[model samples]
Target: MKYLSFTTNCVLILSFVYVVNCANILGYFFFPGKSHQFVFQPIWKELALRGHNVTVITTDPLNEDIPNLREINVADSYSVFLNHEFSNVRRESTPPYKMILFYQEVFVDIFKMQMENKEVQDLLELPKNAFDLIILESHNKMAFGWKHKFDAPVVALSSFGLPVFSHYLHGNPIHPILYPDFLSEIRECTTLVDKVESTYFTLSCWFVVKFLIGPEADALARTYFGNDMPYLDDLEKDSMVFINANPIFSDRRPKTPDVMEFSAILPIRDTLTKDLKQILDNAKEGVVYFSLGTNVRFDHVQGDVKKNIMAALGDLPYTVICKWESESIEGQPKNVHLRKWLPQQAVLAHPNVKVFITQGGLQSSEEAIINAVPLVVIPFLGDQPLNAKILKSNGMAETISPKELNRELLRDTILTVARKENYRQRAKELRDIFLDQPQSGVDKVVWWCEYVIRHKGAKHLRSPAADISLYHYFMIDVIAVFILSFYLTFKIIQLVFAIIVGLFRRKPAEAEVSRKKKKKN
Candidate 1:
């Protein structure tokens, strides 16, 4: 097996030759977040490599020169993300409602930008039946209209966690409290206050996404796909769903057969730089790897918080490898090495590395688990907090809130995670489970994508719940019927009892009146 190093992400040399029954696949990954693109890229890349014609419209394109692949680059749309200062949102404790509103507004602008692109406009103008299947991203409905334009089957692709409303498309069960949305901070709650808070946040987001954001997105789809386009809600009824989540760390939910969990084995160049490899090898006291992930950069951290983090790490005897995008961090210790980028998976896989200090992004979490490395999570945004909560519950990690981060707390937590054997033990046990899957690397995705195409859409696999109405889903209407029946039954019984008492009273009165008449006579 030959491995090529490209900016630290490694692609496995898949052994299977799946060139038979090649089909044309069109992928629309419109959400500008790099993390979202990460989930969908591998599937399209593999399909292209396996002799299928794969055309993708994305904000983050592969930019690879592979045969059978055509990429429409729309990376300039990433500027929409820079418009928001998420660091301020965290500090101000922005209410969940406002946060979601801001989220939709930003994404709406991105959609407008991408759809208006010359390439996307031209692609949309293509004749019907242009592609056999369409791969669509979750969270927004603007791109879902492609199914109508192309007259093809669509496989839903969810990054990290499936959106709350998308769960309905596949008929998966949803409980605001039991299974919280990824956007919500409270995944599972014990206290009444926590449960109430969870319910509010979850249901509020659910309503917003389904009613406000979804309809707006649908209208935008019409703006592009023509005014007569079918509602995205209708077009979204998919039989095959691919969620970029593995069972190891994802919240426990009963998923239908159609909703399968898979995380593409993050491909990386196998070789590490000589200097870094030597540094890791020579770390006599093990190594601590710190990174804030792409969405949350180290520099975005509060000045005090960044200082405390650096101080905490510098105090540790272990060597620290930090991923800082800037040229350098002031007052950084000699023991702490700074790099603009590191092959995260490669570094985590090192035996000498003790624990990963991360922002708890799904990709970082998956890689850490696969490498059997314990975690020190300081979550920033999106699903990081939820991922941190899951990791802590599973005993594979120690978590610290970004707001409460300090030198003593960060230092102590890292030491606790590193020194303890159970953290590593739990990681290894879960790693075994994650690694013990059939097919090598991305072959599973390639097979599923083709399976949907071969079967001409798998409506049989969709859950019955996805089709049931809200009135029927919770049996609210059925409960109303029962309540109405019981009320009527009780009212009839009360009226009958009153009539019996009235008849008895009338007979007594008639007897008294008869006595009086006899006496008078």
Candidate 2:
């Protein structure tokens, strides 16, 4: 009896320990951009640190030898950028659908390459029930089906703010008036016409994703996940939660509780390099930093645009540091300093760095605000225009459309923001607000991640609207019923009135005929 009691205690202790350390997470972040990768890498890093066996298939793989870390690096896809996958994004004023189609074409190729790669395929071919959770980048829908492959719960990573289609996937409310469509340039202060335009853009994007992009992704996923797996579209709706990069400071819109925003995850630099610090410390006239994020390289800019930008920077009294890819920029300004790459967050944090001339990428915009640096944004493609517009609306930045950009305008815009203390003040205010969160972005992600694991994928956190059909979700059929009933009622009333008037007119005509007949008699 004594030996039996001792054995039972040992068994109970062992079970407790196993339960405490039970999570094998697989993260797929195979999007081909540094900015997108930057947003998600930290989440996996923290998960690994917390003793979760985390494996990530990424373009930017882990460099260190961390315990419980596995990486399947497909950096070869960098050639896609070199081959100009995002070229001629806005050569003409293309509509939003065409723009999405263009990106979808590029993304589909990237997805196929990643999945067909031996390493990723090997991971998939592993025995069933391999992982406890799967985190997929929400941009490319191909890998969302990995949930079925591993028989684990899924969590989606949204690099930017959620678009209309993404909201539909997760059952987040998308009010056209309150939240403007992601692609369109409409904002909160829109008129009836603007609302109509925004709603149309939202509907069109939903259709394109459902009929066009969704099918492409579903077919690709079915190819590997087996036809027996739940459809990719269905699996996508079952995502446990969405970790979005949109902070409350960036856009003060309503959000579902299931969506967590880790906006500052990308640019959290606590220290600056010695040389960069020295340059900023010595610049009494102030400093301006310019970089078009990672996607749009400086070398790809047209010669005329480059020349004009250089000339404008040259005229600035402040020292200008630009991220230029070439060894030398022709007609480079005396005051301008060009480097192949600069530590963007460190430079933005410098006290002397006044105005950030950026491509208005969401990460860059958030970084600038976090560091209290105002912006002069030149949006080129994707959601840059929307970011610039909202930042300008918040009075923390000024915008110059690429088409409207010139040497004089660009120079003046930079100087205006640099000299104006209001932009700086507003940026500082937002920075304080952004920093006033209950916990840091890293902490929030790590906590929520563990919570999900502990709760067995946290299905209780999921919104039930995600399971409803699109027609029912939007109440399109209900609206159709109301419209049809009103139309029928209006027709019935019109017919009854016409019949009553005809009867009265016929009686008057009959009386006249009878009087004429009496006269004849």
RMSD value for candidate 2:
4.8
What TM-score should be assigned to candidate 2? Answer: 0.86
**TM-scores for all candidates?**
0.89, 0.86
Supply every candidate's count of residue pairs whose N, Cα or C atoms clash at under 3 angstroms. 7, 0
lDDT of 2 by residue, 1-521 (tens): 99999999999998877445758999998778777787788889888887889989999886778978999998878777765545347523776678778888888878888888898989977977899888878877888888888888887877776668877767777777777766676656358887877777777778898899888888888888888887677787777555444443234555566766675445453466687677788899999999998888756766578778888999899998888887476678777878887788878877899999999887888888888999999988777888888889889899998877799999999999999999999999888877677776767777877777778878787687877886897799999999999999999999999999999999999999999999999
Candidate 2: what lDDT? 0.80
Q: For candidate 1, lDDT tens digit of each residue in 1-521?
A: 23345423433334433347778889888877666677678888989988899999898888889989999998888787677665545412767767777767877888889888898889988899899998878666677888888889888777778867777667776677788777676667778987887788767777877778888888888877888888888788664777777766566778888887776567653468999999999998999999887777655666688789889999998999998876477788989999988888789989999999998888888889889999999988777888888899889999999888999999999999999999999999988887787765367767877888988887678777777788888899889999999999999999999999999999999999999999999
Q: Highest lDDT, which number?
A: 1
Q: Model 1 RMSD to the real structure?
A: 7.3
lDDT of each: 0.82, 0.80
Model 2: residues with Cα > 4 Å off, grouped in runs: 1-19, 85-92, 243-257, 265-273, 474-521
